[model samples]
Target: MEEQPLISYQHVNVSLQGQEILSDVNLELRKGEFVYLIGKVGSGKSTLLKTIYGEVEIDAGEAWVLGNAMRTLKRKDFPTLRRKLGIVFQDFQLLTDRTVHENLKFVLKATGWKNRTEIERRIEEVLQQVGMENKGYKMPNELSGGEQQRIVIARAILNKPEIILADEPTGNLDVETGRRIVELLQDICRQGSAILMTTHNLNLLSEYSGKVYKCEHHRLTETTNS
Candidate 1:
C-alpha cells in the first residue's frame, strides 16, 4: 500500500501583510523523507515553512499538515497541530538563561509532557541523536555554533513529532558546520519523521538526498532532479 503524505499542499496560496509570498504551491512530504526548500531571501521559503506549522495562514487551495486542515484550523487548535511538528529556527533560539537540559525540559513541560522520568529520557534520546549526548550540562553560551544548533535539533524532537519544519537551520554557521547540521537533520529523517527545511544555500542541494523545491516569482516549484 502507498503511504500518505504527512504534509500536502495543493495550489496553496499564502500572503503576508497583503503581499503575496507563495502562490499555487503544491508540495508533499512523506514519512522518513528529507525535503529542502531552496530560494533567495523573500522568495517564500520561510513562508512556506510557516504555512506547514500554521504560523502563516493558507489563503487559498487545499493545505493539510499532520492531518490538520491548514485553512480551517481554529486558534485553539494551533497548539495541538504544532505539537506534531518540530521546528528548528535559523537563530538557535535556546534560552540563554537555562542549561541545555532545562531548555529541553521547558519544551516538554509546555507541550504537556508531565512525567518527569519520561521527559529526562526523551531529552537524552534526542540529544544523543543529534550528537550532543554529553552537553546537557552546558548553557547555550558554552557551546559552539554547531553544538548549539544540535541542541535545537534535540529540542525539536522531544515530542517525536511526525514533521520537522526547519527555517534556514544552517543560516548562521560556517559552511562546514552548516553541512554537519544538515547531516544531523538527515539522520533524524532516516529514523522516522519527515523534515521540510528552508535554506538559501544552494550548495547543500547537490550534497543532500531529498526533494528540492524552489520558490520564485510567488510560486513554489520542484527544481531537483530527484
Candidate 2:
C-alpha cells in the first residue's frame, strides 16, 4: 500500500477576519517531494501556508498535516504540531543581536532541547548542511543576503522536521543567489523531507522542475508545462 501524504488538504477553505481568502482548496504533499505555490501577492499563497503551520485557522473544510486533523488541532497541541514542521520566512528572521550559533541554540532550547552536547552537535550539523559551518560566530547583520538565508535554512532543519514551509525564502536575494537557495531546498527534499514553498519567481519553477501549484482566483490548482 502507498503511504499517506504528509500533508493533505481536501476542500479546505480559509478566511481572515470574516473575509474568505482561499476557497475549495485541495492539495497534497508527500515525503521526498518539492512543491511550489506561486501567485501574485495577496493571491493567498502565504495564507495557504499559514493554514498548514497553524498560524491561520481553517475556516471550513478538512485539512490534515503530519497526521493531525487541522480543525481538531487544539491550542495546547500547537507546539507539538509545530515541532514536526519547519518554517522559513522571506526576511530570514534571525535574531540580529545574536551570533549564528546563539540563534540556532535558542531554537533548540525553546523546543525543549536541554543537553548542551546534543544541542551543540545538532547546531554544527545543520550549519554544515547549509554550508555555513564556519560562520556560526557571525551575527545576522554581518552576513550577506545569501549567507543569512543559508543560516535561516540551517535553522529550519535543526529539528529534522517532516515538512518545511518556506514563504518566499529567496525573495530578498539576487537571481543567482535565489537559484542556489532553491537548489539547497531541492537537496533537502531529496533527503526525505517534504517542502511546500511559496514564491512569485516563475523562473525557478522551470529550472527546478518540481510539482507546481498556482494560487489564484482565491483557489489553488496544480499545473504542468510542456
Candidate 3:
C-alpha cells in the first residue's frame, strides 16, 4: 500500500518579479518524517517552504498540502489551510508586549478557536509539549532566545498541524543550544507530524541522522546513504 503524503509538490516553478526562483521542483513528505532542507542564501529553500504553505504563489505546476491544493486556494481559504500547518521563523516572532499565553491566545482567536476552556486546555497542552508550561505568564522578552523559540514551537502546534515548516529555526541560537532545539523538533516529528526544516547548520545534518533534501542549482535532490 502506498503511504499518504502530508505534502506534495509537482513540477513546481516559483518566480518573483519575473525571475525564476525554483524550477522543476517535485517533492513529497510523508507523516512522521524529519527532513532537512539545506542550501546557501539566495537559494530556493525559503521559496520552496513558502510555496508549500501558500505564502508564495507557484508560477507553474502544483502544490498540495494535506489535501489543500495551492494553485486554487482562495485568500479566505488560507486561514483554514494554515491551521493545518505550523510555521516557525528564524526570528522568534513572538509578541513582545504580550505574555506567552496571550501570544498563543491571539492565534487561537484568529483561527476561530472560540471556546475559552478548550483554548486554555490546548494552550497548556502545547506549552507542556515544548517543556515550558510554567513560563506561560512571562513576557517574550523575558525568556531566553531558546525559550522564546520553544514558545513559538508551542504556538505552532496548538492546532495539531499535520506538517511544520520551519525556516532557519536555529539560526539565532548558539551551537549547543541549537542542537537542543533541533532535538526538540526531532521529538515532535516522532510524534507523527512531518517536519521540513531549512538550515545552514551542516553540523546538525552531520550529527543528527535523517533524510535530507537539498535545494540547490534550482532543484531539490533527495539524498540517501548508499
| Number of the top TM-score candidate | 2
Candidate 1: segments with Cα more than 4 A from true spot: none
lDDT of 2 by residue, 58-116 (tens): 98898999999999999999999998898999998899999999999999999999999
- What would the per-residue lDDT of candidate 1 be over residues 1-226, giving only the tens digit for each residue? 9977898899888889999887898999989888888878988888788777777888899998878888988989999988888999989889999999999999999999899899999998988888899999999999999999999999899899998989999999999999999998898888898888988888888888888888889988888633
Clash number for candidate 1: 0
- Per-candidate TM-scores read 0.96, 0.98, 0.95
**Structure candidate 1, residue pairs in collision:** none
- For each candidate in turn, give its C-alpha RMSD to the true structure in angstroms: 1.2, 0.9, 1.4
lDDT of 2 at 79: 90
Better of 2 and 3 by lDDT: 2
Residue-by-residue lDDT tens digits, candidate 3, 21-91: 88988899999998888889889999889888778898888788888888998988987788889999989
Q: Give the TM-score of candidate 3.
A: 0.95
lDDT of 2 at 39: 90
lDDT of 3: 0.89
| 124: Cα error in model 2, Å | 0.9
Which residue pairs overlap in candidate 2's backbone?
Answer: none
Top-lDDT candidate index: 2
Name the lDDT of candidate 1.
0.89
Report residue 171 deviation for candidate 2 (angstroms).
Answer: 0.6
